[model samples]
Target: MTHSLRLTHLVVRVAVVALLAITAIGATAALRAEAVVEQVPPGAARAMWVWDTSNPQAVVDLAVARGIGQLYAAVPPNVGSSPQLAQLTQLSTLARQKGLRIDALGGDPGWVDDPTWVVDNWLRPAIATHLFSGVHVDIEPYATPAWQTSRSTVVRKYLSTLDTLVKAAGTVPLEADIPFWLDEVPAGKSTLDREVMRRTKGVTVMAYRNTAAGPDGTIALSAKAVEAGTALGVPVRIGQETDDLGTDPVEVKQTFHGFTVAQMEVQLDQVVAADSSSPSFAGLAIHSAAGYAAMTP
Candidate 1:
């Protein structure tokens, strides 16, 4: 063969091999992702919020007994401390051994203004300990009185906070807890819920309602979040409130305190059935570990 022809032939062969290698890598990644998804039982992503880390073993035992697959637990802000770090490491190891995913949980309205502080001071240190699989921030900006006075500004700040957190989290997924009413709030040309979901790895919508199937129930309220998440290829976890808020006027609409655990399960079943078509419908997250334990079925 002529020298020119030989050079062209070699180049073409190299290109073909490179393309095949790339294709193989892509296929392998897709299969791995599919396997992970399959491992998660459908309609069985039972999760709960845990605040106390005093007795990690007790928490792990309870989670195992309840068939919980995930726990959003509160890690101490002083994760730099040896004792706090040790506690988290122990808890994380136990939870992992029992086939449970544990995420570092934190939240505050002030976090909107300075999310980097949370990332640098708490998230990074906790993650460095290799104790958390992800970060779950429950920053309810609406809780701040300033939200009423400067609604648009507050909304923008909240979105910026999520952006900052996502960047700082690096490979660690960052999830946010958002209110169900976020769909009703306008942010720029889109809704607040859409903006938040666009930035975070996943979202847990606090669809804190007593009913499940009615127009104003949890399922209906959570529909928008599920739809948005599905469109964005992000997972949406529907959160139900089980804690007793007593007679507090502010928390009147937040819980199913009077309902039995069986009733709550029935509601959750309805929610799962309603959102079953959405690939991003992650599953249900009960309000709290202690509260759920106290619930009478």
Candidate 2:
């Protein structure tokens, strides 16, 4: 839940109309959501998290210019009746027309406790609009203290919740946002990462480190999971942080903020270059769109 707050997913329910929030992106842009499902980008496709759908035009334009192929656009609750439904649809149409895939993104740590609520209120309605191509949920059960003590229980509920979404999503692919360290945790007979991969479409590891190489760098931190994903034939998208998380040393090292977009891309390029060799490495996904665009010139 706290991959530096994902900050976007934390309150995505409130700002589902903006298109500027960038998410994990791929290397090459795709033609449609159908083109993206179960298929990782050919090379280093880029994905952006667009939580703010307020400006659909700006969002699509930015994504196209950046060569981003996927948009994890947030979905508003009561989406079937929300005033911004048309705005969301416009964004979707524009994105797809420009060869970009848009996935309905929604999640809350609490959603794990009651998947039906989200299914009935958010997922079903959003999917009904036929505005999205896929479903991307960020249920970070780890954010709660219970994750430290009741991890097993939480993992069970979490997996169950995903199952419900997977079923409800029907033919639409469902993916999740997970921390980079999930592979170490046990989920029944398999590791959490592997289990999660088995349930959803694929995963975007919140690998948030700013550098490409180091003991704690992005590549090193995410490599094991990528290998596991490869073995399972699951796609993997490595995520980077751009939001400014001031001060805390460990946290500070996790973002690309304060650096220019060019500087951030250099690091992202390194990640794409390093991981592209793996079949599961579908692409790179930046954590936020606004932050990515706001990066220095």
Candidate 3:
């Protein structure tokens, strides 16, 4: 090769190597960016079954300090109560400041049955609060064989009202609280099926009650719920507990209500794995912020 051509070839080789190094660096950064899930701080994200909006700042501060990502505040119905409004305003303001997402515009179903009441009372204020990122409708009419015939109708009406209410609430997302044992409910399947999920933004499975023990019971409960929800292709947030079930023996406390540290760890690990295993396991939300952090593992 001529001397000039030889120098040009060397320069080209150097440029190629430099380009490769830069590409490698970019790829590494991209991979690291997607590693957010791996670093999820323990009990950092949760969904609380809030009875009241009292002490908004304290709870929000606690959650933010602990690295919690989302907050699903359950707002109970109070047609004429001014405290609800004040509490919601406080929560809304705090959530915005802390950069936390609030789910659920209203509280539960009994309060929401009157479609007009739900619209005029619960929803309009949700838009005004501006603290909520989404709306969660806990519309439980129970799961009985006799109710099956009317179940679909009620659910459809509820979802329809929700669709209208959410639109009125502006850009907030929506989630409907479905029965925890939806998969096993043979007759009430239609009311809580993928069809319902397809029509809504998301779903929360309340997989426990105040009187339960053993993670095994709750785990089995959650597994079935998630499995059914996964087939629907939507986000399913698992609801576990925080309260120490009233028990006398201290040792029983360790295994009380199946939310033991080991059980929680196992459940969370399974949850993380399930998220990878299926399209439905969107994220996890414990029954309360307190319960989540208090979990053993």
Candidate 4:
């Protein structure tokens, strides 16, 4: 290409980047202008998942405005060369300045079959960027077909995968997402919940039920894992769902969808009341940054 054309190309690239920045900043400013910043309890641990990197600055702005303490920002399956790298780096810089912890969040059940590939291609490169505070993996092995057809075999493979992550993570904290009922799935002498907590620095129990109390409620479902975390001295964050989809939209109790954010706060306050005293309890984690932002105020 000629020098003039090369210069023009650079100008266009700069223009596109500047436009995106302006748009994200505009969205953040509008959100701040329209919304009353919700107060989170002082020193309370709170986190939200950020799956959409299309607007990292906007996500960070909301996190700061909302008093959220941590962010589990999603990365592409192969961060070694994913185009999302630049945005993620921007997010990390902004989040750190705002005193928030951001973890590289990436996982898939299929990853259980090849831990080395995941670590070499995704986890290591993401961490090597020095952009993330920790690693949060949501490898739901139970979601795979082999889990049903060959439960024992899949269970062992899942354990091996966790072992690989623990080693790969080294000093960087490694955390995993497990269903609240994983304690029922035996892993040798102990349950999957206990085994996972034993291996990782922390675990987020996806106890998605909206209610705080009762046989099938969030607190009740999370009790076992919370107890295990305490015994094993592992941090445990209880996760809640917020997506609009539900089996019965009108009577959905599994998620905060359709309900006002205020109502969900009331239930989560009850969760704090019940479990905040536990040394293992590490506050609450909303499932997705986008879903939480979309909740009715």
| Backbone clashes, each candidate | 0, 29, 9, 0
The C-alpha stretches of model 1 lying farther than 4 A from their native spots are: 1-43, 248-253
lDDT of 4 at 116: 95
* Arranged by TM-score, best first: 4, 2, 1, 3
lDDT of 4 at 271: 89
Each model's lDDT comes to: 0.72, 0.77, 0.52, 0.77
lDDT of 2 at 134: 82
RMSD of each: 15.4, 9.4, 15.7, 10.6
Off by over 4 Å in 4: 1-39, 247-251
Span of ten consecutive residues with least summed lDDT in model 4: 1-10
Candidate number with greatest TM-score: 4
Summing lDDT over every window of 10 consecutive residues in candidate 3, give the lowest-scoring window.
1-10
Model 3 deviation from native, Cα RMSD in Å: 15.7
lDDT of 1 by residue, 120-179 (tens): 887788778777778888989998888999999999899998888788878888888898
Candidate 2 per-residue C-alpha lDDT over 1-297 given as tens digits, one digit per residue, 9 for 90 to 100: 111111111101112232333332232222121111122325567788887777787778666656677899988887989987988989999987977778888889888789999899998998899888788999898876778889999999999999998899888888899898898899998889999988877889999998888788899999987998889878888889988788898878999978876676667767877887887887888878766656543
Candidate 1 whole-model C-alpha lDDT, 0 to 1: 0.72
